[model samples]
Target: MNLKTKLFGEVYQFGSVKEVLAKANEEKSGDKLAGIAAENALERIAAKEVLSQLTIADLRNNPVVDYDEDEVTRVIQDAVNEKIYNEVKNWTIADLREYIIGLDTGDLELKRISRGLTSEVIAGVTKLMSTLDLVHTAKKLEITATCNTTIGKKGTLATRLQPNHTTDDIEGIELSLYEGLSYGMGDAVLGLNPVDDSIDSVSRIYTLFDEVKNKWEIPTQTCVLAHVTTVMECIKRGVPVDLVFQSIAGSQKGNEAFGFNDKIIEEAYELALKEGTAFGPNVMYFETGQGSELSSDAHHGADQLVMEARCYGYAKKYNPYLVNTVVGFIGPEYLYNSKQVIRAGLEDHFMGKLTGISMGVDICHTNHMKTDANDLEILATLLGAAEVNYVIGVPGGDDIMLNYQTPSYQDDATLRSLFNRHPIKEFEEWMEKMGLIENGKYTERFGDASIFFGK
Candidate 1:
């Protein structure tokens, strides 16, 4: 059978299948709607297998021997109360994959958020992932590797490093870091950030690249660098490079909220297109603790408004490879009503020209009281429900290196007693009663308790 037939067969959405295929075939020169619809149909079809593995009945049924139906009903209701909770709890990984595929094609936009840091941040990431076991648990997830480098004044690292540090020095660092990480975790996507604000900086970057061209492997890697005046210099010098666009927010208390000058953004977009570099602008960026409110004077919430306008304008003018938006610095509002915050951001990007958005969940400060694992889980659920792409904050060195240590974990006998309640025990006994065993055992996979209980 053909790809479409197989996908449709999996999803059991055969009726609209022909209509979808017909629409896909009837392509106009620049008709985006048709393309989006076709992509959506394909994703839904692809996700069928994973979705089949889940059932509301399985989740709703209590495993405890003496479980009270009333309590089980309440828990189920609570879980289903939120839109995201409702949509995701029953979704299989394949369903998620379909959603991701649709997101890639712009049928749906997935917003991914990640905290930013200098090269020193990697150590924090290592510690954080170790604590969470995030990578080992995630299956078939795409990991992207990225490195940020800067232009040094005169005799800085960018300019001074020679044969020992090739142009690929930055790339090499990123690869090495990723390799170390994946050895303990899984594979990831690799991207580079070479900051070129001046001719000298660009020259240094190119020189670095020249040293590593061909010697470096990893064909699937993607590059993200800036398109400054130095970009032209690199091109003239015939340096193999990929460009990435970034928006820098101005200082919080400074004269103005900083961002890419409009003309510069446009120029970079045009240049990257001309040179066939895989480039896209980083839309959402803000300083630590700076919330959603766009800065005034120089940086303002209006920046988001302007970014939306510019992205759509560019999409109309030129068919770029990808358009991305980022929603950075999730505030208390995100914690309180993460669903709403994510929904609004996704709506803005979906209504605009963005192909996808990155949702940032930065935890720069080391106040354990302020951020915790539960907070991270809430954010993860919200992102999953929003059906957007997002990045989790891998603890940075500054966060990990802090002298302050969180309080020691305490056992809660009260909580344990609550679980010992007859209803809870009955539920467990019932699961035992049902003989519903996976590999002849019942297991709990989520929550801290499950980790402790071996269930």
Candidate 2:
């Protein structure tokens, strides 16, 4: 495969697919920190030029991590359909880019071609795409998944109710959840990232979620975003878990840093199927971000975007009900500022959909980052326009437990209104039943958690 190009009479060469992918990426602090980023703007453009000419087969032949050494590589490679691969093996990354955004390529054609591509190829084309290119191409793919209810039905925008508490206080958590539900949120799943991961603490929270779901007959799913093993033990002890949650990385070593493996993940999924509450083949919910593999020292010299795409490929193996990137939560060391964060958010959402998973985003930023609520709003609007499956909804856009900021319950409510979208059909019907929404607009009763107090 050719990896040489000239920009303004200067020669630029990349040693491998890994180098080309890294250099072609738009500026990211993590890649710079890794000492792999292109030296200057001209070199970056040169890398993109060379990357666009590389064929799919070039990427397929050069897995970032060897298949023998990495289970993630093995899973992604083993899953490729040889017949589909052959049809597109000769296509350059540039051709794939135009074809994806071409007028003729809709969801059906994208889905069919997606069966042949690997995570590396996905990352390759992503490097050549503009910010708006990412958004427009993602608009054509409407991926969905089901657990208790379906998400991504074209007119629906769902949310994961993150009623987090710094102390894991039951009353505080319940109060936040009640407030969120009052705002017509939590249709995707009522999930909490608990301060405590002990089985008793998790069990108590799960019991509370179960009691509330039954008492109100709310048509939604519930989960406690604790460690996979903690939730596994909870399931064995009969805690009602609607979804099994895990924060996965693109590589096996990064997953090891998270203290689990494919074996552990597979076992957890099997246990959820046999003993958990959700009725579905899609039983897993995974959260990923750009810098995770690099943070864990498991990036294998690949850039964050390539590693991020590998996440979706790895996630597709289990047919997860939910797969979201907590985009800006990794901080400025990876994404830097608002411009970088927004770009990563769009790229992640598009790559996830292209990988054929139910894609959502936690359009978030840490305190130290050069971003604020306005940047979050901009990205959320773009994601809403792209018809994302869901986004994380926390009280006031601040995650007290995780100490980060994401979309608020009220922000998501406004997003639905702005986009002319509704929650999952069953949850919207439940909202109507509770008098929170009327004729697709909020009623006077909305935003009042007290309605649930007397009941």
Candidate 3:
């Protein structure tokens, strides 16, 4: 079978990719059973392999190649297909890299093609060696969480001002948003995963943020990851909802862990569409992670990474504006340490990006794991380099309610500076106008701290 990926609009025919993942996840799933899944998987893997082949040297060298991205993609595909059919094993990463240098692609398509090509390489290679399969929920991962940037939005390093509001106190919630935003955290959206799921609490949240957004003239979207039922009621009551939020698992039972079913998911997605969005055409924002299936005993014998990628397939049904893969937030049971965290971050990012979801990474860790801020920093910067759409820019990189550390506001600034990235265009302009940022950098590291303290 064939399908066009979301971002690059590349058509892919996978053959080995699905089989490798399935075989890795479930030792019994063979090529015959993989069928269409393998074909889909192969396309993504080939894209990554092809992307890895194109080097800066190749670009800088102006190698004797013409600009034919499609042909370059097809060459990589042909080699991968041959391998998937067990016809050859001659094409290595080195061979593919050298081959890509000969392609004639334009500057615009180079990054897009390169990004699409580079995404799925990690997970495919892991299958040849030791598979990073899921383990039993040996230990409980801290469940303090959390997208609503915009659909079809590009050229911006986006982030959500994610603040966990445990209580229904409007003032407390406002302060969190204000603080995070003051620090340049609210670049694309102000999304909150509320602990209080009460109807009144959820309703108050929509009202509070909407009022705050207007009063403060913050040009961004907002979402509350509440029950679809509550959000639907809020919609019925004429409350604003910029994006629909849900936690989905690859396996059915895993979704049951969060009290979600496909019917409810579809209903919420459809309902949000009626409410309209502040940004692009999409109204859904889904959050996913590895180990949710295994942790909830819903993996259905698929490898965790495969299961994670499968969740993106589910998200695509709604055409989400943002799909965030919280790589390390699930704890160490699935991803042991920083190295595992970094690898998972890359794997999650590539899978999401390859699948064509405007992807982001949390790259965070709870106290339960053997990780620190530095580990998250590495993943964040790497994701930044990968041209991911958004990240979680928390205050001080610490989420008090979730008990985890994400890249802080300053880290976002540092990445933006390093990559020469700007926030969502209108947001960048607003920040510069408001003095929250200066010359595309944050105005205050502590985020207008003196104002919060009345200094």
Candidate 4:
């Protein structure tokens, strides 16, 4: 089948799904986004085709995924269908397909993440290692991938600004940012979930942050997670719109609910390029998860992981700056347990990286999941090792407003210690000069841990 090139917008055809994406990854010149768009388009069409191979009977017969056996390697080796052999390969036909698709997407970073994840699955079923012991080994997988790098640039600790719901007044805004920056968590852009869709609320948060930024000289951009329409209004009203925020869904219909279609997305992107700072060329920020489609009943029967990857395809069109996969927040419907959540998180991070978008995660869970800080920590450590761009640094890992638990500044420190990663160089230099971080080391004396500012 033929698809339009993301760079030149020309139609190109590959005889098979594998060839389509394989060719795309090989093109390394001209506009890089075009190469990325080609890879994304490859995954989009490839996933749809892979999903078609499974019959109701096949899925029903293989419903239980946590079951362990070495049959996957056997199934991949034995499958005579050229399609399965070429584009699919391990745990079940579905997992096997996705694992291979991620590896094939021509992004070495994703391949590394997938390599780690599938190893755990294979070892679990193969009696090679107990699933309970599927820790640390995933850290062995590595890659040399780079994006515009929002919070944690490549090979460094990642950080972000998640100030509750960002419904605070100017004073509150300044204080919260001071707290995070004091802890060296401002390398990533400052992002907030606006309390409502009102353009006033959106403008107020942006204005407050901008004001605080100038007053305190905090080098960060701000995002009020208002609707795309609200952000568009902010742009027209001449308010500061640094990073365009929206909760994106896998299907077109799900996105339509938020007033974002191709036309609106393109328009918002063009506007942001002319306006936003601290990230783009592509300053749009998106939040996505696996169950969003099924939660909204727009999944169209595809697996949650693949469906979520499709959202990346949609996101690449606008060339987003940050796409956060809030892994465990959707409760137990799509990802039922920590195992599933961990796997899905890695898959989301992997797939997004493969599509050539600057990516990060909340590394979070809601009150309703079978996951917790321990589980989130395990995933965070591994994803950090995978060289993911960033994670949310909420105060003490508790979001009083969103009612979820995410990684804290302390956790960010642990990741930095574990991976030898610091914030991006600009922020890192600032930290060094301010004595928040001394000689590339974060000392306790940088700032008072409570109720005070640093630097």
* TM-score (C-alpha) between model 3 and the true structure: 0.70
lDDT of 3 by residue, 86-156 (tens): 32133343443333333343324323333333212323333332212211010011111112333224346
- Report clash pairs, candidate 2: none
Assess candidate 4 and give its lDDT: 0.59
Total clashes in model 4, counting residue pairs 3 or more apart in sequence or in different chains: 7
Q: For this target, which candidate reaches the highest TM-score against the unseen true structure?
A: 2
lDDT of 2 at 131: 82
lDDT of each residue in 1-455, candidate 1, tens digit only: 12233443454332332222222321111112122223454554342322233232222232111124222222223323244434444543334334433343332223221111111111111111211122121211222212121110111100001111134355544343332222111011122334335556555554444343323322221333444445545555655444433433222221123333435545755655556333332211111222222323322211222223223322322232222333323333222233323332333332221221122222122332244434434433433333222221121212122222111111111111222211112222332333322232433321122221234
| Full candidate order by lDDT, most accurate first | 2, 3, 4, 1
TM-scores, all models, native as reference:
0.36, 0.99, 0.70, 0.69
lDDT tens string, model 4, 167-261? 55656766677777778886667777766668887788888777766665665667788888888899888897778878887666666655566
Q: Which one wins on lDDT?
A: 2
Alpha carbon lDDT of each predicted model: 0.28, 0.92, 0.59, 0.59
lDDT of model 4, residue 200:
81
- Where is model 4 poorest over a 10-residue stretch in terms of lDDT? 25-34
Give the poorly placed runs of model 1, Cα more than 4 Å off. Answer: 1-176, 180-189, 192-216, 224-233, 248-262, 276-293, 296-370, 385-455
Q: Looking at candidate 4, what is the lDDT of residue 275? A: 65
